[model samples]
Target: MRISIIDTSSLGDRSYLIDDGGVAVVVDPQRDIDRVLALAAERDATITHVLETHIHNDYVTGGLELSRLVDAEYVVPAGDDVAYDRLPARDGYVIEAGPMRFEVLHTPGHTHHHVSYVLRHDTQTAVFTGGSMLHGTTGRTDLIGADDTETLTHAQFHSVRRLAGELPDDTEVYPTHGFGSFCSATPASGDTSTIGEQRHTNPALTSDEEAYVENLLAALSAYPAYYAHMGVINAAGPAPVDLTMPATVDPDELRRRIDTGEWVVDLRSRTAFAAGHLAGTLGFELSGSFVTYLGWLYQWGAPLTLIADDPKQIVEARRELVRIGVDEVRGAATGAIDDMSAGSALRTYRVTDFTQLSSGIPSDATVLDVRQDSEYAESHVPGAVNIPLHELLARAEEVPAGEVWVHCGSGYRASIAASILDARNRTVVLIDDAFTNAVELGLAA
Candidate 1:
């Protein structure tokens, strides 16, 4: 069997397409099925099976839609209480698709119903670990609930050991999560690894079960708020992804939307957004973390709109939003900021590097560190107030009255915080620089 990776870097997850002979099976596809279809077409393979390892908690699954489109069998874990029809996949059940033979293994860690697929063809063997045994760690056990975290963590330890014990040392490991995903119990290491490599490096393999559980729990950080919606949508079967452009809103309409407290997001670079943007519009630059942060802080089902320099940017941003089930993008505006300003003055903020911060900041300025609580505890600027970016919207009232200077690990998140403060009519300056520079320049205490 030949395997192809379908990476959705925005969410730090990967889907897989494995083909043997002329038949193919897709595993853990995102909501947008067009990319999977295109891959199958390019490979001259027919999709005969769409498999979901579990009801995902990070993004809506496209397995059901893709199966219907290709007339393939939709396979889901037998233990899940899903709403749609599916082929129930259970442990030790073997399935055949052309030359590929899949043996299902019930690995309940990430979610109670999660499973992994071990594929065998000719002389080669590989395992598709959806969220179980990741590269250097296991999938987080806390998504289900705080009450079940310890139970699942124990199960996770045994599950990883089972895979390591049963699978051959050379079995190539392909996991769907842990590629910079918050789903990981800890940050994943390396790009690719084998079962043998994992036995040596993975925390589940190297540490005792209790030690592993304690370390994993201690390291878990805040996940996106949108995650609460993904499992529900996936269990109910997600709607077909809509990638068509949203209605174009004129400058007047854009202004009205912003004035009415609607979500009119600016999808420009941090530097560009910091320089000038529509007053009251949010700056969630269309970058890797755009979907993640926006989904985290967004009011669910809100009538969203986008502002971009080009129509193509909005199109790309729309695709990202759909994966997280933020489907109510009501309108878009594309072109120069002046054109979309609708006769109002564009808001602007000053951005500077950390070296300037090291020299001196205004005595009356309040230094706002927008990194997470865990990140703040590691090292931070002396006397800087810590309000994580995800919490800024709800805690905006906590910011002190002064010229507020906001910053994060990189300037991306700080730009977001800066926009929020600017929209609130607060005097703000954005520290648009890497946090490492702050430590290197003796700015962090």
Candidate 2:
């Protein structure tokens, strides 16, 4: 038996390709199925099953499309109301692929119909616990709804304990979420762990059940805004990924697109963006957490034109964007500010350090904390209003008039927020310094 772990580092999602004697099964694949297909081809294996542990809320899955591409059985959980035709998988059902046998265990906590698959061949066994259990923690239970938060947490506790109790201690465990994914309650310690190790170290297993639920609920962090659209898109079945590069548009076309109220995302370094960028273009640095922030800020399915430094950058950016279901990449514009500006105007914003703000904040300026709610709650400048960077586009009007001074955990998010404010013609000052220096800088927290 051979298992291939395909990791999408940008989203921290993992898809598994398990092959036994030239027959393979893919689990929880991302939108891009090429890698999985290529791996199967390299192994000289024919894919016989495509399994979805649940309807994903973080990224669109390629299971349906992959199944059609390979002529494999698309197996989905029994209770999900997915529109596509699939083999409804039930609890305790066993599936066979070549020399392997997979037993389905209904684990309903991350979602109403989540299930884990236990693959067995001879004396070796491996469990694929989609979002139910992690290496050091369990999946967050609040994504579905607030009403189901407590109930799901309770279910998660029992589900986790059941897996730990029922599975042999030596069984290898694999989970889709938990590797730096927001879907996890906390970051996982590593990619793989044994049932015995998890039973001893996992928080969900070690803590008291009631206390675990309370802590899990309390520790739940704010997920990306694009998450709201993922489940709906997944349930309805997303179109196959088009890996074609977005068309390259000239300056006039870019101007026309921006003039018509389309998103012109500048995927350059924050320093380059702060120096000079096209007016009305939103600066999202391509170097740091590009996909997370872009998905957070962009309107789902909206026509978007990317501005990159080169063809390579555009290709990388589009790959990241499509994984989150941002498929309407109209085209790309690549060049210096002079080349892309045409006759249009260029804009710049002022960046300041935390020490300068500590000395004195302008009386007319409103300090905006653009970090997530949890980050702001942990420590923030006194009198700073908390409006996460993701929500700023829709809630910009709520920010009072005057200059807007923005700061985040570091300078990255603050720069993005400052660019948004600059595009709106608001006088903006970016606090570009390490957030860890806030206390030493004598800023009120």
Candidate 3:
């Protein structure tokens, strides 16, 4: 048996294409199905089955669409009241494709109906624990609701133990979440792990049930606000992803959109965006974290537009947005920053590093730290106000008036916060440097 990992690192989730020379099975694919199709073609294998561990709460699942396209059986957890037709997967259900055999294990933790697939061949063994048993941690339990978090965490503890006790110690472990994904209960440790390795490393296995439950609950932080919409979309079956570029908008239309309070996002480097950008445009640099934060803070169903240094950036941004169900990117404008400004002078903010911050901040200048609550609690610049980047949009009024200087762990969130502050007509300076620099410079308290 051979397993090919399909990593959507931006979302920190991985899909798998496992085959035994002739037939393949895809597990937990993202909304974009082309990548899965390309992998299957490359392997010279036919897709016989597409299995989903659960109705995901992070991104739209491509299982239904991929199954339909490839004329394969779509398998989903048995109890979910989904809109589409699927092969109901129950505990102990066995699926065979060529020489590969998959035994369904109902591992409820990430969701009430989550399942893991144990793959077996002549001698090789592996388990795809979608969100149950991660490398070092488990999937977050609060995604369902505050009311159900404890119940799920308890179930999560048992689920991990069951996998550990039942499966061989040498079984290769492949989890769907935990690689920098908000879905993890805590930061995931390491990359590749085995059942034996995880036995010693995973909190679920190492800690007692009560202690594990308590610690998992305490460690949970804020996840994306957009997650509320993902499960509903996935359960109903997501539509085919449209990667085609949105229509280009001229500078006049772009200005009109911005003036009307529509979301006009600028996808460029944080430094470039801090230097000069359209007055009303937001700076969400086109990087791995771009889609996650943008989806979190975006006003759902709003007419969204994009501004970029190149059209290619906008194209990639659209692909990322579609994964989280940000489908209608109304229009886009790309080119020189000055040209996109439409006759009016572009707005600019001061970008400084921690060295400048270490020198001295003015007595009255408000220092805003836009990292998460947990991050700010660890350590921060003295006298800096803490409003997490996700909360900044709603709590902008809470930030004190006059000459606000903002910083985050990295400058990405700071640039985003700075742009929002700039849009509100506040005097803002962006600290575009790593937080480690502040500690090195004796600025962190």
| Error at 350, model 3, angstroms | 0.7
Superposed model 2: Cα runs more than 4 Å off: 355-363, 440-444
Ranking by lDDT: 1, 3, 2
By the TM-score metric, which is better: model 1 or model 2?
Answer: 1
1 or 2, greater by lDDT: 1
Q: Residues 191-304, candidate 3, lDDT per residue (tens digit)?
A: 799999998999999999989999999999999999999999998878888999899999999999999999999999988987888898899999989999999999998989
lDDT of 2 at 221: 84
Error of 1 at 226 (Å): 0.2
Instruction: Supply every candidate's count of residue pairs whose N, Cα or C atoms clash at under 3 angstroms.
Output: 0, 0, 0
Query: What lDDT does the true structure give each of the candidates?
Result: 0.93, 0.89, 0.92
**Can you tell me which runs of candidate 3 are displaced by over 4 Å?**
none
lDDT of 2 by residue, 1-445 (tens): 8989999877877999999788999999999899999999999999999999999999989998999999999999999998989999899999999999999999989998899999989999899999998889999898899899889999999889989888999999999998878899877887679999998889888999988988898899889989899999999999889878899999998888878889999999887888889988898888648898889888877899999898899988887887889989989988787799988768887888888887787788899989888888788888999999888988988888998888998888988898888888888888888888887776747
> For model 3, what is the error of residue 336's alpha carbon versus the real structure, in angstroms, after optimal superposition?
0.8
Q: Clash pairs of candidate 3?
A: none
Model 3 lDDT, residue 112, Cα: 95
Error of 1 at 305 (Å): 0.7
Q: Least lDDT summed over 10 consecutive residues: which range in candidate 1?
A: 353-362
Candidate 3 global lDDT: 0.92
Ordered by TM-score, highest first, the candidates read 1, 3, 2
Q: In terms of TM-score, which candidate is stronger, 2 or 3?
A: 3
Candidate 2 lands at a TM-score of 0.94
lDDT at 406 for candidate 3? 93
